[model samples]
Target: MHDIDPGWAWSPVEESQQPWTRQLAAHLYRRAGFSATSETLDEAANKSAAEVVAELVDGRTESEEYLAQMKQLGRTVVATGNVENLPAWWMYRFLTTTDMLREKMTLFWHGHFATSGDKVTDPQLMVDQNELLRRNSLGNFGTLVAEISRNPAMLIYLDSVTNRKAHPNENFAREVMELFALGEGRYTEDDIRELSRCFTGWEIRNGRYRFNRYQHDSGRKSILGQEGPFDGDEGVAIVLDQPALPDFIIGKLYQFFIADEPAPPAELLAPLTIEFRENGLNIAPVLKRILSSQLFYSPHSVARKVRSPVEFSVGFLRALEGSTDQYALTSGLSELGQVPFFPPNVKGWDGGRTWINSSTLLARSNLIQSILKNKNTRFSNGTLSDLFDKHRLNSSQEIIDWLETMLLAVSLPETVRLQLQSKIDSGSGNREERLKEVVHLICGLPEYQLS
Candidate 1:
């Protein structure tokens, strides 16, 4: 189950110790974000998977750099100041970004944690929260939740600060139980009431956490059939103890990192939950265990899940030394339903089939056309042909190779290849237009959707 299957028709596994190892690492890194430099990919790929994964799973504290980012980000007490080039620059970061796995994992947490800039109403606060998500993305799941639970940004976004004693607001608590923590059906209305009380005094003041001693309800209440006047942290502690917590979280993590359909056996996940809870919510060890599991590398895992627009866009641009016009890139992503920094709701954009539709397909094709024409919005007669031949890809086979790598994690079948070649060889189609057509076809295909 080592994720090795020679019959699958992927390019042969270059020997790990060979110079191509870096090339392989670059490939994986590119899938996560920007393309890798030879040196960068070599550094990542040279390490054994264990070593590389360890680096990815852990996090570093760059307080000095963080303070700089914070200072540069600039904050107004009003929380709605406009940012300049930094917004576009961040998009660039994701495209040319390093720390490949961290970026990917942080994106996963963004969906899991699920907050939006719209409700938060403060770009800087949202940015801070985003950085926090990235910083702890792979390190610890429980810690991530705990910090997010009290996050001033989250409080404002979900109206948690509005929660009070005379009437406990269940908005934040319910989501914490239903959406974030135990999934759904694991906790009930009564549990929600008690949880809300525990968070009653957990308020945000002038953009900082200010627990109100007066508003706090110290009175006992039952949660998940357990009785207590459990405060906020204690409430989280209690919820984490549930038998299903790990299964819920582990299942989610599995979907993000491995096959979307992969499920953790109750036995495997139970122990993982216990280990996570016992380890102060540190997620690194838990993920190390998960990734190291024999089941993780099962044949079903590789290239199984569909890449999101962010993944597809970033990965393609990295591999092809590609960049797109700023607004169009944003527009293309918007049309695809995965705009960065603008998640749809607190739940974020749902993945998988939701990413595709007739509208989205047109948007993707247009983006391809734009890339081909050096930013032309409309296709001219034979304009695509001129562009392809201009690139000097005289041989139809070269076009096929470019499309294959640019569009797939692996090669396509010979039959598919021949069909594309035939399309290219057709006399009527312009070479550049045909090239664009080929890329468009591949991008539109089902296989191209998968990683």
Candidate 2:
């Protein structure tokens, strides 16, 4: 990666270098959003990579009808007052929503500004926070930081619901610097103390954020070489103004959209960091540049990320045009580790290799098996066999090739491909069951675990 030129890496790929193809389209869709269906991939392959990425980044807004449906579903879940149901609600959106990049970015922000339903308890507040993340997912970073600072779910989760002046809670302050904006070691302990004082009157009352001036500490404080009686907003501005903020955020984004291992060198990230900083932290442009870049379509990023549990399951369902009981799906996701609103901790899921272990790997295979076995699971509103027939996948080779193209990020070994063919030819049960078994087997492989 260090050997790659920063300018050429971020530049658009030429047709001579990498012609737009279904495989490249699949790579873009997998990294940009959840995976796309083969039909979608075909449509995307007809266009230039720039055109496809422009569509993804520009088409951030969901249609009014889709928004209404999502809003109604969210309301229904909140009405039940059960946070457990929220994951299913989001899973439904993940499967059905057309505005893929927005949803994907919302998921990214959910991990970045990690807040859990485990502590917040209020279903409405949690739903509101989810919406908050979605609304600002592709917008201004400074604005997102400002809005999330006063978000009730975040306040409650961070134990800053009542940050009194007498004993200011340092939780939000420390996290705002360490996790949210600047990376760790970018700010000092004294900075956290002073920043916490700035947020002293912030509280959550009646499920909304409120500031009680009486509890605020009005004393002058110094933070990050700036002196002022900074309120929470100003304190956030100061933190966002730090020199390290761009590198920190761009580094994280690189890991998310590019690769998970072999942390990007400072030189490689310099171009993106400058773009992000110059654009006033507008996320869409940076994303647009990254998605259309030469490096994004190259070997470095194609299969670099390990699919998180959400990506693993959601990508499969989306790619196959499959649907199933979302509640059961959410349960399976929980068993596999990522539970939407219920993140494991403030640090979120450690993603990458951490997603796979002996137990979770087994759970992942079992989850796929359970989905395949469930009568409710359907592909294109019918059985898997019917869907495959619709696509005219008659021969074992055609079916295996199609599965390999749509599902796996990396190419299967020749031996593995032959093994899959053998299963399709001789596995137990009817053809549908045999095909399903082959899919299950493929998903269980180490290759399928990658994004």
Candidate 3:
């Protein structure tokens, strides 16, 4: 409930407690939310790992507000039958929202339980699903999965209504195990078939979920070694109780928050698993444990993952003033791969290496330049230096420092810095023109794109 204090920044630190800690925190902050500004970096670095985590949860304020907003947004959206230009909507949200965390986590859930607007074709369903994810995103994995399974958007996307006792569709059931809950190979084909039968009556009608009691078999079936005439909820319960389910869920958190590699040995996973099971699957405790863990900051984990395009674009937005028009910026993000709710497929975009291909990289470079020039979204102060100037940035050195601090918080090569200064000096322009070239260059480079 605390309003953001403009004065909040990291305390001045004399040195690193662990050199690797700085890198790990930066990586996690960017991945979990947006990119670092000089301001956010000050807030994130040199704190107890637990303190660093406070920032991730900082974005939670808008969930309650967003719930109300979504109701209005949804009603207006449905009556008009608006097929949202996904990028433009997201662009506006990214700039205007106090619920950046909600929006950001909603993004995570969209990918984790992948769906398609192409299939659902209802923006209300999409908007509704976004709320489900925001509410439960860092709350409960088990409940989140159950809610997602029942969601109208997902039901339509995965063909749940087609599921029947006589000839059940396995699409939703199979994915619940392979993709959503149990990951791969944990549940058998029979389990999926039986699970689909339990869910036979569950259907989306006029944007509501209905259970057709006459259609549901309510028959006993064996799933994960548990035998029952399990209905949808019971099927979900059986799947949740799987031994691999905790590891699967925790492993996903590891990949999302820690690293792309496998999770730590059983020693590290067991406590979080127990916390998940005991805490009614509230997710913050598990995430808190991971962020505070020594393993998270180990050298092997630092800089091991790449920023998803959304993160990259959001980071760019955060690096500037909150009022910056991101429509132009996100237009570039759309071209690169990520376009908020509009992912490339049912499986979503493969982040990490998939985000760094030849065409995508060029898009990244050009996007930085485009955004700096206000070519994508018109900027009140389109030039980067004016953004700097609005904050009263003076001197080429100060401008360079601001870019390094805000846009590229990580260390830049001195050679690159010198070359940038040379390029700026040779250009016959004011401070805006001079600093724009340097800020643009930093974002356009491979190093900026990498993390």
Q: Which candidate number would show the highest lDDT if scored against the true structure?
A: 2
| Model 3 Cα lDDT, one tens digit per residue, 217-245 | 88788777888778999888888878787
lDDT of 1 at 53: 50
> Could you give candidate 2's per-residue lDDT for residues 142-176 as a string of tens digits?
99999999999999999887689999999999999
The better candidate by TM-score, 1 or 2, is: 2
In order of TM-score, best first, we have 2, 3, 1
- Candidate 2 wrongly placed segments (more than 4 Å): none
* Number of clashing pairs per prediction, in order: 5, 0, 9
Find the 10 residues in a row with the least total lDDT in model 3: 4-13
Q: Where does candidate 1 stray beyond 4 Å?
A: 1-47, 58-89, 262-280, 289-298, 374-399, 419-441
- The CA-based lDDT of model 3 is what? 0.67
TM-score of each: 0.78, 0.98, 0.85
lDDT (Cα, 0-100) at 403 in candidate 3: 64
Candidate 2, 333: how far from true, in Å? 1.2
lDDT of 3 at 164: 68
Better of 1 and 2 by lDDT: 2
